[model samples]
Target: MRVVSLVPSLTEAIAVSAPGALAGVTDWCTHPAGLAGVVRIGGTKNPDTAAIAALRPDLVIANEEENRQPDLDALRAAGLQVLVTEIRTLDQAFAELDRVLAGCGVRSRPDWLDAAEAAWADVTPDGPPVTAVVPVWRRPWMVLGRDTFAGDLLARLGVRNLYAGHAERYPRIPLDELNAARPDLVVLPDEPYRFTRDDGPEAFPGAPAALVDGRHLTWYGPSLAEAPRSLARALRAARR
Candidate 1:
């Protein structure tokens, strides 16, 4: 079936899950190098509905947390069947894909999930219960605090979130406040931050620091195939 995947993570998912079925993707959907030439439908939150419509897809895949409400309704109104997914945990991700594939009449999720789970199991889930801080944005600087997928993923790896004391999922935090909190690991995401190794080891000389790919940590869709490995890789890189 012809499909337009507006969700960025699903771009990776479509590569393994549905293969050539994707007709269009959001600008952020750049995982599979082959998608480089595909039409860019704008950002994840603001897709070009006209471009999506011109693709004439039989199905459009979106995420509840990723896309705005109007986008979902507008796509549906265009008479294209839409599949919306919301995932809070790994199980939820699998469940959603099950529905999505079923809706598309595919009857199975892409095989990457099985491999991901196996890879996740190989990690032994044996890691120090370190405290971590994940910065989402800069300038007024916000951070993921509690009940977020990053928080849960850290919990799974036996790491606890330092800012989880806050009520919001992502709380605005001052750099000084974070410094004082003394997290075992201070994380900077690629988005809203764009941290690079060139910034140097002495940048946060007091603690372990890492510049992580935000999508791998937070995207709970089929992209999870890479997540378990990415987390383990991140933790190992932290040793330096």
Candidate 2:
């Protein structure tokens, strides 16, 4: 089954589980590196519908959060079948991954998916919950808020998002306000924005900074298998 994947995580999952199923992929689908012959269809928010349609894929994969509605509409209008996924938590991620893979004609569950489930199953909070501010972007400073997959992952790892109750899923809070929140830790991921020890930590003098891998913290695919352990190590190091 030929498919075009607009979601990065799904692209990696499909590439690893059902090889040669991807006819096209977005420019940002960077995991499982060396995607040699796959056609590049532009970014997730602004995929080239004409290019995607020309590929004649049996199915197109996307995420409600990462992809634009107008793009999905255009694809459907052109007689393409689009499978949009919404993942707000780890459970949803696993379920949606299964659905997307099945849509790609994968009859059996991939071993990576089973391993990811087992990995998360073994995770328990190492200690008392530590409140944190997880900034996804800088400039205007957008943070993970409300019911976000990243926030839920952090919560499971014993890190509570300071803005988890906010009305917006990703809220742009003023830098001053974020500092004023005085969270115990400042959790920074490398993508959506590249937050390094030098770039992100200086802003929050009051809280210790935990610089974690963006893929492990955000992407929900094969990386999920190692996220709990990788994130736990980063958090533990930050506290020390």
Candidate 3:
């Protein structure tokens, strides 16, 4: 089955479960580098509908985090069968993988998933919970504190996620409230915000800051294997 995967994670998902079936992938979909030479279909938020239509794929894979609805609607209008996925938490990640397998008509599941789950089970945070601000943007700024998959992942690291209490995915907040949160660590993801710690004191005033790889903290699939180890190293180095 010829398929086009628009989401980044599903590039790996389709590669692992439905190899050779992936006819195209979004530009950001880079896990299975074998697809590096595949057709470049722009990014998740902005897709090239004309280019995609020419591919004549039997299926299309998209993600809620990546694609805007208007673009997806355009695809649907073009008679493309798009499968949009939403994996906001750890369990959802596993479930979404199975969903892809089912959609591909693949009968057997991968053994690596079980191993990934087993590895997750072994993560033991090394420190007392530290409050953190996870800003996704710079101008107005947004963070992941509550009700987010990232927050859940941070919880596994034994840190109290402040945004876990926020109402929106990336809420726009003032500088004062962020200061009032009294976070021990103000974190900036490598993407979305691209935070640098050298300017931490100047940026947030009182909070200790660290720039971290957002992929490990956010990407729940193959990239997750490195998260715990990296977090362990961060904790070991965290000043008391």
Candidate 4:
């Protein structure tokens, strides 16, 4: 079955499961590198519907949050089969993986999926929760807010998001307000915005900042297998 994957995590999962089945993928689908010759449809939020439909794919995989409704609607309007996924927690991540794989014609579960489940299954971090404001963007400072998969992932690592109860999923807050929160730490992810050693930490002089791999924290695919350990190391090194 021919498939076009708009979500980066789903792109990697499907590619890993059935290498050559992907006829098109979004430009941001960078994992499992060397996706040579794959047609680039555009970014997740603004996929080229015409280009996607032109590929004549039997199926297109998308996420409710990562993609826009109008784009998915246009694809459906053109008579294309679109599978939309929603993942807000680790359990939802696993279940969504199954749904995507099955939609893409992979009946058997991938070993990476099994490994990821095992990695997060018994995670019980010792200590009080580390309060953090995780910034995904720099300019104007957009942070991970309520009901986010990234926030949920951090919660598993004993890193509680300071803005997890905020109304917006991704909220833009003033730097002063974030600092005023007096969080124990500032968690910085490398994608959507690349927060480096010299870039994000200084803003929160009162707290240590942990620069982490956005893929591990945000993407729910093969990387899930190593996210617990990798995130743990970064959060640990951020200690004051």
Q: What are the TM-scores, per candidate, against the unseen true structure?
A: 0.85, 0.98, 0.89, 0.96
lDDT string, candidate 4, 1-240, tens digits: 999999999999999998888999999999889887789999999999999999999999999999999999999999999999999988899999999999899988899999999989878774678899898887788999999999998898898898999999999999788768888988988988988877655567667878899999999999999998888888888874
Per-residue lDDT of model 2, residues 1-240, tens digit only: 999999998899999999999999999999889988999999999999999999999999999999999999999999999999999999999999999999999999999999999999999998898999999988888999999999989999999898999999999998778767888989999997999887555567768889999999999999999999999999999998
- What residue pairs clash in candidate 1, if any at all? none
lDDT of predicted model 3: 0.75
Please give the distance, in angstroms, between residue 204's alpha carbon in candidate 4 and its true position after superposition.
Answer: 1.4
lDDT (Cα, tens digit) per residue for candidate 3, span 85-109: 8878887887887887678666787
Clashes in model 4: which pairs?
none
Q: Name the 10 consecutive residues with the lowest summed lDDT in model 2.
A: 198-207
Error of 4 at 111 (Å): 0.8
> What lDDT does candidate 3 reach at residue 50?
80
Rank ordering of all candidates by lDDT, starting from the highest: 2, 4, 3, 1
The TM-score obtained by model 3 is: 0.89
Q: Which regions of candidate 1 deviate over 4 angstroms?
A: 197-205, 221-223
What are the per-residue Cα lDDT tens digits for candidate 1 across 1-240?
888887776667665666677788887876777774467789988898877988999889898778898988888888878888877666677677677766555666457777766765665555557777777766666788776767777677777788777888788986677657777777766764676664323234477776677777877556566776777677768856
The predicted structure with the larger TM-score, 1 or 4, is: 4
- For TM-score, the strongest prediction is 2
Clashes of each: 0, 0, 5, 0
